[model samples]
Structure formats: C-alpha cells, structure tokens
Target chain A: MSNIQAYLRPDSLEGALALLAEHQERARPLAGGTSLIFSHPPRVEVLVDLAGAGLDHVEHAETGGVDIGSMTSCSHLATALRGRQLDKSALTDALATLYTPVLRNHITVGGNCVMVYGWSHLPVTMWALDARFMVVSHKAKPRDVDADTFFERHPLRWLGAGELLTQITVKSPAEGSGSAFLKFGRDKSDEGIASVAVSLRLQDEKVASARLVVGSTRPMPQKLDDVAALVVGKRPSKEVFAEAGEAAAKAVVASDNYLGSADYRRHIVASLVRDALAKATQRAGGAA
Target chain B: MKIRLQINGNTRELETTPTRTLLDVLRDAGYYGVKRGCEEGTCGSCVVLMDGEPHMACLIFAPAAVGKAITTIEDPDGDRPHAILRALADAGAVQCGYCIPGMALSAKALLDATPDPNEEEIRGAMEGHLCRCTGYVKQVEAIKRAAELMREEASHE
Candidate 1:
C-alpha cells in the first residue's frame, strides 16, 4: 500500500506551487502519474495533482521556437510536432521509439525530465538540440536554464523545495541544419541499452558546427565535445563519421551490467553514433 | 477518500484509499473483465481506456481517475461484442485468452481513432500486449479483419 494520505488537485499553477511550498518534502506534484505509480516515496504523504492546472499546451514561442508546457504528454507532443511540421521529426521519432503507444499517452514531458532514469531519452535529445527549461517557484520569479546546465548534474539538484519545471523552449533548427536520434535496445519496446543524438549544420558543403550527445549507457546524458570537434571543418563522409565514432567510443567510460559488458556497450555506442550522424548529415542536405 | 468515476457510461461514487489502483478498484466493484496480470506497467493485461485513450489501469491511481470516462472490455459495443473481439474469434487469435481483454480494448481504441489503420499501425497498437499462447501473427491478421468489419458496418449505416 502507498503511504499517501491526501490528494489535492490544484486548478492553477500558482495554487499547485503554493501547496508544494506549504507541504515541503511531503508533497509531490503528479503530472501524468506514470512514475509516481511505481515508486511513491515513503516520505510522501500528499499528492498535488497537476491535471487541472492548465499546463498542458504546445505553443509558438516569441523567440521563433516552440514553448511546450511541462505537463504535455509524449503522444500530444508527437501529434503537435507532426501537425506543425516543425522540423522536429527527430524528436517525434524519439518519442515514438521510447515506449509503447499506451505508455506514451500517459507519460508527460515534465515527469520524464524530472525523474532522471538511465534509459531516459528526452534529456539527450533536448541537450543535443540546445533547448531551454523554464523553472518557477512560488516566491521567486521564473528562471530559464539551458539544457547543458540543467543536465550537467541530476536535474533534481537544480529544482529546489518550492520549484517546478513549467515549460521547455526548443529553438527552431537553422537553415541547412538537421538532427537525428537513435536508440539501441534489446527490443523495440524495451528500454534502450545505448542511444545517441546528433545535430549539425552544413555550410558550403562542409560541417559548420555540430552537437553530439550520448545517453542510456551512462549515468546521465553528456556531450561528446572532442568527438564533435573532430567534424567541425571536415566534410560529411563515411570515413569522417567512423573516426568520430571511434573517438566517442574511446572517450566514454562504460561499465559492465547485466544487459551487456563495458566493451559491448562501447561498440554499440560507436555504431549508433555513426548511423545517427549519417542520417543527420543527409537531412542537412549533405551528400554522405 | 470518496471519489466518483465514470465507468462504462455510468457515474459511481466509491470510497477508497488514495493509493489504490484503478484496476483493483474496478475489479472489486464487480467489473471482472479487467484482468490483473503483472502489477507493473509493463504488462498490458490491466489496460483500460481512459478518455478514449488506452492506458495501463495498474499505473493509474484511483483518485486520479475522478473526471475521466473509463471503459472496460465488458460491454464496449453496447449490446454485442465489438468487431475486434469477433475478428479475434474468427481468426483463432485466442489461445490461453489471458491477454485478450486488454488486447481487445486497445484495438477498439485504435480503431475508434483510426478507422483504416494499416498493418504497421495495427502491430504498433498491440505492441504492449504479450501473448504466450499464439504467436502475434494471428493477432495482427485479426486486427486487419476487424478494420474491414468496422468499415463494412459503417458503410451499411
């Protein structure tokens, strides 16, 4: 049985934050309720439901990007992105490949981002895309944190007692730029063993800038700066991508687990990075 | 906590704990068609439609289902078995029958949203269900047959 003793449904974001402030560590905000169902902490005695808080929305940001409310479900986000044709098909693909259709309907962006799991997909995708997170507290003004800083450590460290994530803004992809995400799992429906996300821009048939992130095999998603630097001035080619993959494999520190050994995961990561880079380069109007 | 849930087009007020799952509550309330398999969310045996979208009932807290309309395998099509159920029977898709109820509900939701789903879409809709009895080939064929039956029934109307 759960240790929960109170259920409070707040009609607004302010109301929800106030409740969290009052209850402190004993209260948890429930959005989609997928993760809370499995692991309800013993210290939690109150659940502040966010369903009625009017936070589920996907809107165009003033900065030309899309501002997604934290409560937006994965299925809803996929539909919105597909309908808008926002050049975020990579994100939609990642969401589709994360879990089954039913689970996707109930898992929200906020819950998935806040609850950092090893196999989490969105953090890696967001980090590669250079997205920004909007976090709000009851007593202070809202603050924006870039994906690099937010995911630098466990996201929970950035979130204080009375603070919660409210929105995520993804900058629109530049012209001649494209992104792709790939996850290697035991099966299509299982959690990923290794995943890679690549975003790159092409200029004069050469790689102008690139951002590559690897996750699912590490404790948290991390940017491969050395690997990305290798492709800064080189043209998109099979040899270049393969070399970048080899550098990535050597850079990451993988450990042995029940699913696979450290060497095996490194091999999988190398292959996934190569494939994702090829796809992103193709989308960026480069001949690879 | 006393909560009201709209199940099968009827609103019922029930007294339950805040931590109880919708699957356990509905089963105890005599809606036995909701099968209980893996208590975890991985298995699809406890799937139920909430607000016309299929979700694992075991993953939903009872009080959290206050305002949404819940649908079960029992009486999904008013008086007759749904087209998906008939198609499954016709295609011999049921072997052990443990996963049928959840699969049927998931199929109904899929067809409700998309009337003419293709083979890939059918397989994607039923990916959460794990059936050890018969291989998934028959179930995919059954969903295709169900789509045909539904289209035919709609055209007649």
Candidate 2:
C-alpha cells in the first residue's frame, strides 16, 4: 500500500505553510508530483499540495529581472521566457533539453530548484544567471538565497521542516549579454552526462563578464571560476573558446555514474562548454 | 477519500487512497487506453490530458486530479477520429501499439495549440512518446501529415 495517509490542499500560501509547520517532518510539499511521488518517502505521511496556493505564475518584477513562481512548469517557463523577448536564452534552452515534453509539462520550476537532481538542467542555468530563490516558512520572514549559496547548501537537505521555495528571481542580463545552454545526454531520453551553461557580456568586442557553469558531471552544478576568469577581458574568438573548453575539461570535477565514466564526462563537458561559449559569443555579438 | 473528476467529458466519482496515482485510478476505472508503462513517469505511456495539457498520469497523485478535467485516449471523439490517429494509421505508425494512445494524446495536445508545426516542432511535441517499433520516422511523418489534414479541414470550414 502507498505509505501516504493524508493529503491537504490549502487554498492559501499561509495555510499551506501552517500545515507544513504543524506536520513538521511528516509533511512533504507537493509540486507537480513528478519527483516526490516516485520516491514515496516512508517519512512522508502527508502531502501539502501547492497547486491551489497560487504559486504558478511568471511576471516581470518592478525592480527589473523576472519573478517566477516556484510552481510554474518548465513548459510554462519556456513560453513565458519566449514571450518576454529577453536576451538570455540559457534558462529556456536548458528547459528545452530537459526531459521529454510530457514530463516537462508537469515538472515545475520550483520543484526542480529544490530537488536539484543531478540531471536537472535549470539549476545550472540559475548558477550562470546568478538567480535567487525566495523561500518562506510558517514563522520565518521571507528570505532570498543566492543560487550559488543555495546549491552549496545541498538543496535536497537544506530546507527545514516547514520551509518552501515560493519564487525564483532571475536578474536580467546586462546589455550586450548572451547566454547559451547545451547538454550531452547518453540518449535522447536520459539526462545529460555533461551539461554546460555560459553567460557572457561583451564590451567593445571584449568579454566584460563571464559565467560558466558545468553540471550533471558532478553532484552539484559548479561554476568553473578558473575558466570564467580566463575568458574575462578576452576577445571573443574560436581560439579563446577552445582554450576555455580545455580549461573546463581540466577544472570540472566529475564522478562515474550510470550515464557515463568520469573521463567520458570530462570530454563531453569540454566539447559542450566550447559550443556553449561559441554560441554565447555569437549571440553577444548580435546584442552588441 | 471520495473525489469527483471529469474524465473524457463525463463526471465520475471514485474512492481512492491518498497515495494512489492517477495512472492507477484511471486504469482501475476501465480506461485501459491509459497504458501502464514506466510507472516511474520516465516513459510517456501513461500520459493523459490534464486540463487539456499533456501530463504523465503515473506522476500525478489521484487526489490531486480531483475537480480537474482529465482526458484519456478514450476521450477523443470516437465518431470522428482525430487527425493524428487517422494520420498515424494511414502512415502505418503502429506496430505493437502500446505507445499509440499516449503518442496520440501528445500529438492532439500539440495540434490543438499549433495546427501547423514544422518538423522540429513536431519532433519536440512527440519527444515524450517512446515507440520501440517504427523508429518514430513514420510517427513524425504522420504528425506532419496530420497538420496538413487539420489545415485542410480548417480551410474547408
């Protein structure tokens, strides 16, 4: 029999948080149910459905950037991003490479953010964009956690008993900024063995700022600071991107998994990072 | 718990546990068209239209589906087979046919929104369905053909 015994659908966020607080460790936040339902954790006695909590939305923020509700599905996020006519396509491209359309239709951005599954693509994009997560609980005031710090905290284990990620804020890229995401999956259906996301801003045909994030080859997506530093102030060129690729291959930390071996992952990461950088540079040229 | 949901345009009430997936409940309710494959939700065999959007039933909790409009393969208009199904049959896109219902539903969802999608769009739309047989070339052709048929039908109207 399924171990879950209780289901609660609160119409308000406060009510949901209150329920989460009361249930404590026994309550699990349910978003899309794609990830949580499969594990069927023995400790999860109650599911607090966030479907009715008005968390599925994408809107522009007054302070610039975009505020996306945690419950917004990847499909919805892609559509929203396309509609906004933004310069950054890393997140959208990341979502596009994610699971199949049916799964993407149900996989919520919030759940992906919190779950941070090794194969998930959005966290890598978030790392490139320097996104922030807005989390709230029963008693604590709403707080924003930087994407890098959030990933460092080990997302799956970080949330307290009652805390829920309510929103994600992705700041708009600077003018002449371009970003791209690429993944090399073992198969068409499986998650990527190596994935790369690159965001670069150009000034006078030189890299003003750069962020390169590599994921799926490691437990958490890691920003290749060494690689990013090499690209900054460098002119965009095939040679520069190739050097960055080599740097990424050397700097990335990987482990063997069902998808690929560490060596194979290293090779894939290098190639993808090169392609991602080239694409980002080309887009940056256009933006410039 | 007792819940009422709209499936295939019919409102039905059923008794279900909190943990039952929509896939289990739908199959038990005699919707055999909703295939039971990859209960992990990786495979697209259990996909259904939840509020007119394609979603894997295996991943959705039964209680969460209450009050939502659920559409199964059986819900498609029987008298007039959807252009997708017709195209698939015309192109001989079925082999074992285990994945057809889900594929058709995914195609239908796509065609409903984008009547004339390009090859890339078609492939992206049906990426969720895994047909071990036919290799998806025929399926891709069938969806492209379906788009033409849909456009023809719209023009004639």
Candidate 3:
C-alpha cells in the first residue's frame, strides 16, 4: 500500500525543491508517476509532482544539439526527433522498443535516468550518444555531468536532498558518425535479456572513435572500453567486428538469471555487438 | 482529498485519498466500464484516455488526473456504442469480452489521432492490450474496419 500522505503540485522548480527540502527524505518527486505507481515505495509520505514545473520541453541548442527537459515524455521525444528525420539514431530505436505506446506517453526521460533500472534502455543509449545531464539544487547553481560520469555509479547517489535533474543535452553526432541500439528479449514486449548500443565515427574509412555500452545482462550498463579500443584505428570489416564481439563477450560481467545462463547472455552480447557494429558502420559510410 | 475530474466530458467531484489510483476511484464512482484485470500497468485492461491519449488508469494516481479530460469505455455519445465497439462486435473480436473495453478505447484513441491507420499502425496501437481469445488478428481487423467506418462518417460530415 502507498504510504503517501500529501500530494503537492508546485508550479515552479524552486517551489518544488523547497517542498522537497522541507519534507526531506519523506518526499519524492513525481514526474510521469509510472515508477511510483509500479513500486509504491513505502517510505514516501509527500509527493511533489513536477507536472506544473514546466520541464517538458525540447529545444534545439545553439551547438546544433538538442536540449531535452528531463520531464519530456518518450513519445514527445520520438515525435520531435522523427520530425527532424532522425529515425535512424539509436535514441529513436531505443524509444521505439520501450514498453508500449501507452506507457511511453507517461514515461519521462528524468524518470528513466533517475530510477536506473538494469533493464532500462535510455541510460545505455544516452551513454553511447555522449549525452550530459544537467542537475540543479537549492544550494548551488546547476551542474552538468557527462553520461560516462553519471552512469559510473548509481545516479541517485549524485543527488542531494533537494536536487533535481533538469535537462539532458545530447551533442550532435559528428560527421561520418552513426549509432545503433539493439535489445534481445524473449518477446517483443518483454524486458530485454541483453541489450547493446554502439556509436562510432568513421575517418577516411577507419574507425576514429567508438563507444560501446551493454545493458540488461548485469546490474547496470557498462561501457566496453577494451572492445572499443580494438575497433579504433581499424577499418570496419566482418573480421574486425567479430574480434570486437569476442572481446566484448570477455569484457562484460554477464550474470545468470531466470531468463538465461551467463554463457547464453555472453553469446548474445557478442552477436548483438557484432551486428550493431555492422549496422552502425554501414550508416557511417563504411563497408561492413 | 477532494478532486474534480472531467470524465466522459462531464465534470464530477469526488472524495478520494492521495494514494488511490484513478482506476479504483472511477470504478467506485460507477464507471464499471473501466475493467479491473491486473492492478499492474502491464495488462492494459484498465486503460482510459487522459486528454485524448490512452493511459493505464491503474498506473495513474487519482490526484494526478485532476485537471485532465478522462474518457472511459462508457461512451460520451450517450446510448450509442462507439464505432470502434460496433466494429469489434461485427468482426467477432469480443470473445470472452474481458479485454474489449480497454482494447476498444485504445482503438478509438488511435482512430481519433489517425483517421486512416494502416494494419501495422493498428497493431502498434493495440500492442499494450492482452487478450486471451480471438488471437488478436480479429482485433486488428476490427480496428481497420473501424478506421474505414470513421473515415466514411467523416466524409459525410
């Protein structure tokens, strides 16, 4: 049962933060309310709803990137990106594969980032895209943290008593860059058993830089740096991609769960990474 | 807490707790058309339209829906069943009928947003719903037919 005693919807971010500070740990910020509805955490006494805070906007940044408010719903983001014909990006692929249209309408970017579930897709995709999270608090000016640093530890640990994530800034993909996200599950709607995201940039038919992140097989998504190093400076080829996949299989700490064995998950990670590399490379104007 | 909700285009005031879901409140207010299957959000049996978008009522707190237009399976068009409902019946899509209310509401929302949705669009819109009978092919076909019927009605208008 929900332990909630008060529901406060403040019209401003400062007001919401003040309410959270006053209530301390007893209050939790409610964005889309999907996670709260699902978990119903027992410790929550007051709910400071962020709906009226006006955080759900998507704007094109001056740097040619996108500044997405934390409260933007998945469907809204998909529509915005699709309008720009960014349908081939990894973020869209991940959003399209998220639960369903109904749930996607209510699932916000902030909720997905703050809640940090192992099977969550956005974090892995964001990490690969080199996104940055903007966080604000009552005591200090807003600070931006790179995705690599944000996902290095539990993101919740970075928040203080009254801090809230404000927006996510995804830098525009560089020239000759392409990214792809893939999830493997028992069924289309089921939570992913193994997921992989690859973002790479090509330079004169050689891999200039790459980011490889894997999710769902472990407690949190992790970047395979060693595997990425193997692909850097190398031409995109089936043999090179296969070697990178083998390296990824050994790099990840795949766990055994009710869904599959650790061995099976590792195999999936290898195959998905290889295929994702091929697709991303092809999009990067490389022969794969 | 007292909250005012616009249900099926009618404003209604109700006394509810902060934690009770919209599904519980609506059903208690005699909106039996909002079926209760899985209390969790996955089943989509308790779906309703909030501001013309399909949302699982079980996952929404009653207070959160205070200012939105809430549409249940009980048609606002009075006694006449919605065209989506009629099409489902005509297509034999309602076997046990447990999932029809939510399914029809989803179909109606889809057709409202997209007057002429293709087969894939219909399937994508109805993917959240789980039905034990009819094998979902009939439901997809019914949505297609419903879209056709809606388009024809629009032509007359």
What is the DockQ for all candidates, taken in turn?
0.83, 0.77, 0.79
- Answer with 1 or 2, whichever has the higher DockQ: 1
DockQ for the candidate 3 complex? 0.79
Models, CA RMSD each: 1.5, 2.0, 1.4
Model 1 misplaced stretches (Cα beyond 4 Å): A61-64
Reference-based lDDT, residue B7, model 3: 98
Tell me the spans in candidate 2 whose CA falls farther than 4 Å from its real position: A61-64, A187-189, A286-288, B155-157
What clash pairs does model 3 have? none
Cα TM-score per model:
0.97, 0.95, 0.97
For model 1, residues B113-157, the per-residue Cα lDDT tens digits are: 999999899999998898999988999999999999999999999
Backbone clash pairs for candidate 2 read none
lDDT of 3 by residue, A119-189 (tens): 68899899988899998877678889899899998887768767899899888778898999999998765
Please provide, for model 3 over B1-157, each residue's C-alpha lDDT reduced to its tens digit, 9 standing for 90 to 100: 9999999889999988887899999999999989999888888899999888899999888999988999999874457877788899999899999898898888888889899999989989988899988799999999999889888888998
Q: Candidate 3 chain A: worst 10 consecutive residues by lDDT?
A: A81-90
For each candidate, what is the lDDT? 0.87, 0.87, 0.88
Best DockQ among the predictions, by candidate number: 1
Return the TM-score for candidate 3, rounded to 2 decimals.
0.97
Could you tell me which 10 consecutive residues in candidate 3 chain B have the lowest summed lDDT?
A: B74-83
Give the proportion of true interface contacts each model preserves, from 0 to 1.
0.89, 0.89, 0.76
